[model samples]
Target: MIGAGMGAMAAAARLAVAGHRVVVYERTETYGGAVRRFERDGFGFDTGPGLLTLPAVYRDLFVKTGKEPLEDCVELVQVDPCARHVFADGTEVSLPNASRAGVVAALDKALGAGAGERWGAFLVRAREAWDRTRRPLLEEPLWPNWQVLAEKEPYPAVAHRRLLRTRQARTLSEIGSLELRDERLAALLESSALAHGLDPRTVPASAAVLPYMEHAFGTWYVHGGIRELARAVYERCVRRRVEFVFGAEVVRVLEKDGRAAGVELSDGAVAEADHVVADVDPAWLKALTDRPLDGNGDVRADPFMTRPGRFALLLALRGGCEAGAAHRTVVHAPDPESELDFLASADGDQPPPPTVTVLRPDDPALRPDDGHESVVLSAVVPSAADWDEEGMVRQYTEHLLEAAEAVIPGLRDRVLWQEVRTPDDTDDETGAFLGAVPAPALAAGRGRFLHPSNTTRLPGLYRVGGWSHPGGGLPHAGMSGALVAGLIVEGPEFRGSR
Candidate 1:
């Protein structure tokens, strides 16, 4: 195995159970890749994703790998009133967890009269897209003739009567405008795509499944933070006797007789193995292989369509969290269009305050004491931003902090210290190019935006991680590991996890 991220660890655990001498070579000294923790002055914050959705992906891994389940390894708490969304029009809605009816009711009450029903009706179509793509996109490996999956838009979009001709909504933005009707409701729908670094204007309607997946599974936080989930997986790998070599950066993949034989490390040490499972990002993987990866024989240099990075503000405040606050609050941008445009632009145009996701886990383990609170403010920005400059980082950090005051009242006054992390930090940590964060795989129409196949061109080599098939996000990354292990253990005929 290569790299000790969640996907690599997951593949290691499963392969270990199958009696493979799994050894993970990570460039960093730690196990988790981008899922890292920062601690200072008795306060801790998760530098990556703070919440987990579609946890069943991990549950299945635990059930299949060992005697104890995932819950036994890490405490999982479902966030009630999953998130609070403050719209541009001063409309605030507290969306409950895993409840469609509750969401509909809340939207209706908060937005307007028929707002809930419109959103509810849109979810029904989203459900169709989910069911249609679930088997092919999630459960099954990318097929040989995968163009069928890409060309077909499974989202049963409502035909809108605009003028003379009735046309079905194609893009996510079109669906939001034609079906959702209201601007605020459209923003609500667009948030799912924007969160994944996808542009609502271009992403196919299949992207609707993104929101459906979250609302269906419910957002959950590990007791300490999301980094704890990585710890649990690493611990499980240790219990199974999977060896981990830290700081062993793989320089090149040694090929023997047209197959991957082993890897040459940065320290000039060669570790030979029968098979090599790569958990690194796409660019890093290509550099190791020194060739285009085999994805139905048409692999591009950069497989990803949209590579957006996160700008995170880790704040240690002096006061405790209020009695009952939503675990996650999205301070929506006043001009959603302009914000999206700025995130889409490569040049550093000061975006009108980007939509910020403020995460404040109620877990006491995160803070020094009840008196202190650990809050994270994260916003999606262009990975091409000049984040290497201190002035740019400082300016954006302050902008996010100011926007966060909408939820965390008097945030500037209460802040004891702040740490800023840019895409450069992500690139340094995970080896991703330009520190670009990969979005979850979306079946963009016209055979566009689909992730590369897990089984690459090189024999005896496999791809497993956010940058591989099924794309980024916790559940997808975990599933990528499962798919890779299944292919190696059960051969190319393997469909997916049963």
Candidate 2:
């Protein structure tokens, strides 16, 4: 495997079981890609994705290894997913899990009857859209590299949904502001847009799948830190006897007879495999390609460029944060005008701190009420290129703390220890180009061609990670990894030389 990111590890585990000799190289001393963690005193914090909703993926992973998921890996308890909106106008409303009825009732009480019905109607449509896009595109890998662009069944509907302007664009107190109105609900909907680094006025409706899926599947937290996912994959690979070459920085991918042969490391060492899979960002993988191939065989990963860097804060706290059965995506978003205004300029390749995600919406274990609440606030910040380490640290620490303090009184003073992970940290640590964390931008304007997808470019090579097709995000990443594995090993007809 190219890089030992989580997706890469998952792919490596599967490929190894399929009887291919697998070797993984990682630049860091540790493995897990974005699944990094930190702790101080009595408190701990997961530096990356904490709210894992899709349990089936993990279940399937363990089953593949002939092990029980809960026994072999971390146990996951379903969280009652709900988004509580604290609008600037000083109104707070919560929309809860699969309880679309409750959401409608709440909206009727807060917004309008018409608005409530509209939301329900849209929820139904969103669910349908999810169903339509689920299998053929979202859960499947682009095979043969030509089917997507060739004379065959292409995913135009799925592509259209991803590329078009989201429902957030037309409504919710922003640009279009179509029919039913409750300014508070409007603000809540708008806040959801910023929650994902998207502009409410521009993000496509498909993005709404997050809320719908959260309600349907239920939000969840791994018993320990979410980083347990990395641990599980690592253990599986080890059991399969996959060799993990830590700190082996690969510099070039060797091509022989016009097919992938092996990789050359920075230390002049070489590791050969039947077929190579890239787990880093596409741009990063491109750098290692001794000579760049067309790389255009699949538009899934290479199609969409990247988004800006994220300004993240991992604070080991001295106190606990409350989380009930349901979770809340806290967005201390400035007013709509300010939020949209900032989003427009965000692409200047400029770093601006506006949105703040206070994630432990639910999960008292991670954030105990008695004490030990790990708070992580990640916002889009200026790239490492824009500022020096000292400057970046100072900015992230001050701005994010101030924002958190407003939500939790005396938060800055309560902080026992702080570790600031700038977008630059993401790049330097994960080799993500432009410091792109998790997934890059699939802007509304560019719409259709976004999302990291497609495993292989042509016949032999495979790609997965922050820059591949189907786009980035924990589920997308995991799904893309499995799809690639399935295509290479279990697909009805592709013979990847092993």
Candidate 3:
């Protein structure tokens, strides 16, 4: 394995159990790729993903690789009122975790009588899309005839008639206008896509599965931090006898008999293996090999070349946790169009206060004592923006703090100190091109949202992680590892996870 990311480690553990000697070479001194923790004076925060959805992905990993279950490895707590949404129009709603009726009632109580019903109706349709594509997109390898997935849009969009003409929502923005109808409801839907660095206006209607999956599986938080989950997986890999070499970067992939046989390290040392699994980004992987990994008809590696990345603020607050505060709160932007325009623009202008997610997990492990708290604020921004400019980063941090104040009143005053993380920081850490975070693969727009196959053209080479099949997100990356292991252990005849 080329990197010790969550996906790579997951694969390492499984491959080790399958009687294959697995070795991971990570350039960083530590493991867990982007899944990292920041600490200061006993206060800690999860700088990567704050919450885990569809945790069954990890649960399955533990069950297959060992006798111990995932719950035994890490404490998983389901977050109640999964999220609190504060819309631009001052409308607020606390959505219940995995309860359709509860969510419907809350929406009705907060956004008027019929709002909840409409959102509920949308979820039913989103579930259809999920069922239609779940196997091909998440469980199975990218099919050779992948164009079938591209030509088919699995989202069952409701039809509307205007001027005696029938039309169905094709994009997420249209679904908001034609079906959702309410601006606040639309914002709620669009924010889910925006959180994943997707533009709802252009993203496929199949993207509705994003919010649906969250609502269905419920949001969960592990004890300590999400980094704890990564630590558990890393420990599991070690227990399985998988070898890890940290700070050992693979400079090039060595080929033997026209197949990927080994990797060359930056120190000019070579390690030979029967197969090579890469968990790095597409651009970085391309630089490692002279061979063409994908043919013309194959799904392109960098589908969304200019996708946005996250800008985060890790705040150490002076106050203790509030008596009744939602664990996660989304503060919507005042002008959604302006924020979207800024993201789409290539001129690198200062962005307006974008929609920000404020996470305040009430875990004792995250803080020094009862008198202090750790809060993380994140927003999606253009990955190629001038994040290197200290002034720009500072200004964006202020914008995020200002937006977070809507959810966390007196936020600035409560902050004892703050740490800022920009796309440039993500680039330095994960080596993603321009720090662009890959969005989950959606099954429309002519496969533009789909990721490349895990099996590359290079015979013994395979791809795993967010940059490969099924695309980004915690669950998807885990599934990528499972698929890669399945392909390697069972050969080309392997179907998928049962």
Instruction: Show where candidate 2 strays beyond 4 Å.
Output: 70-72, 109-115, 143-176, 179-183, 190-193, 290-306, 322-327, 340-353, 361-369, 382-396, 438-449, 452-455, 491-498
Off by over 4 Å in 1: 161-166, 295-306
Q: In terms of TM-score, how similar is model 1 to the real structure? A: 0.97
Clashing residue pairs, candidate 1?
A: none
Better of 1 and 2 by TM-score: 1
User: Residue by residue across 1-498, what tens digits does model 1's lDDT show?
Assistant: 888988889899999999999999998889887899999999999999999999999999999899999999999999999899998888899999999999999998998889999998988889988988887788778888887877788888465566656667789999988888899888888998888888899889889999999988899999989999999999999989999999889999999999999999988999999999998877778889888776434532364444789999999999999988889998888888888778777655455688889898877999999999999999888888787677778778877888788898778899999999999989889988888877777775765667777888899999888887888899998998899989989999999966
- Top candidate by lDDT: 3
Better of 1 and 3 by TM-score: 3
**Model 3, TM vs. native:** 0.98
Instruction: List the candidates ranked by lDDT, beginning with the highest.
Output: 3, 1, 2
Runs of candidate 3 with Cα error greater than 4 angstroms are 161-166, 297-299
* Candidate 3 lDDT for residue 363: 93
Ordered by TM-score, highest first, the candidates read: 3, 1, 2
* TM-score on alpha carbons, each prediction: 0.97, 0.83, 0.98
Cα lDDT tens digits for candidate 3, 337-424: 9899889884655678799999999999999999999999999998978886887788788888888888776878999999999998
